[model samples]
Target: MLKKLCLALALLVMPLPFVATAHAQGQSLNDILEPVRKEVGLPALAAAVIKDGRIIASGAVGTRVLGRDIPVTIDDRFHIGSDTKAMTATLAGMLVDEGKLRWDSTIGEVLGADLPGIDPTFAKITLEQLLSHTSGIPTDTKAIYEQYVDGKAYEETLSQSRLRMLRAFGKNPLKVDPNPTFHYANLGYVAAGAMIEKVAGETWEELIRRRLFDPLELKTAGLGPQATRGKFDAPVGHDVDDKGKITPRPWGPGADVPAGLGPAGVAHMSILDFARWAGWNAGEGKRGPALVKPETLKRIHRQHVTMTLENPPPGTPKSGGYGLGWGIAASPWSDNRPVLGHNGSNTMNLATIMVDPQRDIGIVVTTNFPGPKADEALQSLVRTLYQRFAK
Candidate 1:
């Protein structure tokens, strides 16, 4: 709600009749996105507007990499960093639907036999807390890097590495005493992913592809780096230097946030496919391939914890309710009704999605860039689309 007024400002500047005419005539989303992309100096930007379970408007604009002539298309894949958490959570929900797990399923109950040395406190942590970021797991960048990059975690299998991470971090004392305090941590998702994969007898990567991607028909979706190693087949994520220069990271281990963290983030797909996922979530089980029961899906969207940010960091909500992989907040554009939203970034690329189940509307925006400018550009575009579409 902090920047809700920006949408109001956008309303004042962008005339209603013009937007109505453009929508009626099936105007290219490029017309609306190009100016914003230029204004923000993003390498590339893609977005789609989903209304009533259909992509009513969609577009991709700008170059594949900044300072290059190679252009991007609507089909180009873009990395959606932590937004992958929702998919992982959804996978857990699927397991729950199949009677493989439960929301109250504890780490000890699921993994204690495997990890005999797990901390007693950590052993009691529930799947719900892990998904909601209320499991007392603090953000530990050092632990992640030590395990994934600097250490030998990458050499082992993904599931093995995650187990190692759980063993290592579980020994530490809880970050918060009460157990339900909100402390966003990628590690929590990693642990949750481990539990899901263990119960399902597959890796998180395979589970996501089979359980979520294939079922949702998100053909463009994939794990790890979006672009191919040698070819610019997709829009590569760009890194902004201290001098404001942008560099595209297309290949190598550095392209993604470590394969082991797949359960937490490191997913990429075309904007339309991403919009399809958003649209399905917006449908709130009304329309679906029935990935999970409608009540179960609704439970995932329900707020589990309240996140109160005193001085919100870049790309974070000022204050909102966080559900399983979703930021449940009131969208001013939607008359302040609670909407499911989330922003994902790995400091190179950014992706944001907002789903209004009540309205059956979803807006997804992604760019081959990150930081304040990209965030503002996407937010503005979302507001613009909400103004034109959400009828």
Candidate 2:
């Protein structure tokens, strides 16, 4: 387990961007984030709230990278990591609406022709299983390594490698049998993406870009690293060393956890656009971009089963269940109903989204650093936003 250290006092080193909280409240969203960015020692932090398919508040603060003068802006893209999972699941739901796929479609049924040598047991894995993280897929493997570590992406396309990995995975026993127990697995999503390709004849990335990003009009949305190639278009991810030194990383193959793992993560966009996306989810398909029906959204957000963390961190549920792409937990702040949201990280950047459909409020936050510090900071950030905006 990683140790927790509160560095909120690090605000002392940060330049005073505002004279007081009153200024932050009356000023741009960036002003509100300035203090939190400083307190968390973040190179950059961006956040927003959305209600009824519209962004209500959004802000960005700090520099694009450590030791650089390039300031973070609300329009700049920020990596959202595993938060992309919700979008992928939403895509699957759209396909379901089109009669191209079913929630219970089995992995072997969809891709069996492409892989004849796969294990018979894997044939039973269903789309619902994959989306809900109940698939019997192992959480780790060499292919998983390649998906995250650019040096190991190998020579094959992400989908191709994932297919091969699936075959290899089929040969081995499942990590956990499909049922209600939740076991987070990136490969499960990769497999889900492969199934999407088999049915739609397009890569997961291409599908997401066309179906979701295009229609949503998310101007800042893009795949791969948040930063532009060879340029600081936005905040680049940062890696904090054990010595507490923060190093800015450039855009590269290793810039993200795994570009090939697009189905699981690897999406970035502006905080405002992110808020729009979350707000759409909060609408549960009643809003425009009517990509999926309300019922389908219901199925996606419906809790599948409880999940157990071996070493649960403070403030997180020891046994939380997951829906298609979001974590389902009852927070005291929610007035006793479950909230839907997720956290994403590629080991260098972190983003989180928490939404309450009952209250029609959604909150999102991103930081340019990864690890326990970023997680702790963002957790507090989301709670603050939710408490403020959720009525």
Candidate 3:
């Protein structure tokens, strides 16, 4: 179907208008997410809402297999795709707080002369520029981009393995250089992850487990396919064919994204845990174990660059900007200004998390199936949640 067209369909593709301002029916979160799952034909779907650092409402609906009778649970994991960017950026901030790295530290400075074939210009790229996707790194080009989706083992250390992909981009001139407009660059995040590897002197996976996941207690969080290694205990991602018949594909090499691209996305967890992280961010560092200082989290959420969507991608906002890891926009139904949320997918799944920092509330939704239909379903569900719960 539409999912097989390209890796990601960038627009929301509004299927119909939503009753965003409708009063809550005292309906459970399951009541809200289940119908959307059925109507959209997603293999499985999950959602949760967090207020004041706690999950107040959460649920899941549908089956692991699209046409089968296997049921899913609230604990079933779903890949959150690029939504992982925010978490990676946060981990980087922790290192910065410890003075292990600086926001302005250059890749050249971090890797030193040890990395081979890196151009002088690329070496000059900084943490802020890289994280913000304005460091002159091009959005992963098609050939280079596939390197991430395949889950290839990049050889040695995390930084060295990931940096091999950057040699292709090292000397490439930027579309716009020196603090240009926002461009979604997956490679840029990988580059940043490399810097993290050097500073932490550990694999990105180890650092995430020790520094973030362990502290936050994101029990369901992991890298790659949500499906367990040998079984369909979790929902398996599907690949839709030309005639629209979805093939249920279990977790395998093709299902995993390259670890080098982990900083850009490739994270999977239950909807509840995803919302927990969002809620922590919603508190703006005031709650949830104080992962970073309040101002640091605020800086992460602040609008750093604006995006113009005159003739935008399919899923892009009509008019909006981007913060460090979030797309900054306003909601008509909620009093939430700069409604902070992001849509994530790996061409086989779709997920979203919306946080209203003003009310210290966050909402997250996910679908095991991907494409335009998934986007339409998630955008509608998010609208319902914010309209019903936004302060």
Candidate 4:
């Protein structure tokens, strides 16, 4: 396994923008990406670069499955995994702008009634704390398995199940000081999603679809596995075994993380649409359906906590400042201007987004296969993109 690196780019320069070489201008995105995909042994790879809120270049290459001839098109959707966190955080910002929520909104203020016996300390965790992963909720553990993973809670609504999680986990003493300690916890985002659900009276999925996706015109955006049921209409995720065998997990409940954790991550879309989202962020509400104030959007992009992990799990940040849903860091290649980014994976696929607001440029990369090779592939592709486009 590759040593865990700072951010996606950190693994490759510590880790985006434009000016293609004379020859690069003649090259299609497929021309740029195919060899890297082959070198990395990925089933498929896709990428897009955006400038001033539009995709300037994008492409998808390789097959939908490893041992198949079916090819993937630029329109094929890929699972974004934890990159969904930034979307969830942005959705929260929308609510905050509407006065339905606040950055400082506390758990007790939102869900204390629902969770009557909640620990006072846990209840004090705020919306900002939750989204920033500073809420001190323990990371996945045995208790999480017993209360959530094992039960699956198929009978309960997504919101209902999240509430169940809040009730069960809220009673425990927090794992760290809720203020400064940074522990990346998906459960915190789930709790924040539940809080949004409580105030909005809609499931997180429904609210995001209407409030965020519809307004942004992200038509291909959806929850769960990116591929349609029983059809490889999109790139299917691949699981790599220790022996290096790749198995296609095209579609199913088992293909993704729990539905209750959708708030934490689990969004997918076409590479172009993904670029649209990143470009919107890079524009900082400069153009919009005006989802949130530019200032509010800035708040979401601004780092809230310092990440000190020497070795983070694959596809997450190793070192950087984490904002509500974004990772803020200066790459070795970026000349010290902090860039906003995040990588997502479900152990079957990996997706990455990097935005350079100062340059009004954003880069996104995705692969149907997940692992060190995929990370390295993205790192190389992103570096190539920056070298070609950011001039």
Over the stretch 36-90, how does candidate 3's per-residue lDDT look in tens digits? 7878778788877788776766778899878888899877888888888888889
**Candidate 4 lDDT tens digits, 1-391:** 1111123544343213233433312224887678778887888999988887767778789999898999998778988888888888888998998899999999999888899899888999999999988888866666664665646578888888998988988888775662587777778888999999888888999988998889988889998888889898988888667897767998876677777888988889998888889888888878888988888988998888998786676545567798988888776667777888888887788888888888888889998888877887886677677656665
Question: Residue 351 deviation, candidate 3, in Å?
Answer: 0.5
**Cα deviation in Å at residue 100, candidate 1?**
0.7
Candidate 4: 10-residue stretch with minimal lDDT = 1-10
Report the C-alpha lDDT of model 1 over 162-247, residue by residue, as the tens digit. 88888888876664576367777788898899999889998888999998999899999998889888988888887677787767
C-alpha TM-score for every candidate: 0.92, 0.89, 0.89, 0.92
Clashing pairs in 4: 9-15, 10-14, 17-389, 17-390, 18-389, 18-390, 18-391, 19-388, 19-389
- 1 or 2: which has the higher lDDT? 1
lDDT of 2 by residue, 1-391 (tens): 1111111100011222323223212224676677777877788898887877666677788888888899987788998887888889989999999999999899888999877777777877899989887886755556555434544347777777767767766666554543466667787888898898889988888899999999988889998888878799899988777797766776776577555678888899988888888888888767787888888989899888787777654334666678898888776666667788787877678888888888788888888888776777787777766766676
Candidate 4 residue 184 Cα shift, in angstroms, is: 0.8
Question: What are the root-mean-square deviations of the candidates from the true structure over C-alphas?
Answer: 4.3, 4.9, 4.5, 3.8
Alpha-carbon lDDT of model 2 = 0.76
After the best TM-score superposition of candidate 3, give how far the Cα of residue 161 lies from its true spot, in angstroms.
2.1
Candidate 3 structure, TM-score to reference: 0.89
The order of the candidates by TM-score, greatest first, is: 1, 4, 3, 2
lDDT of 1: 0.80
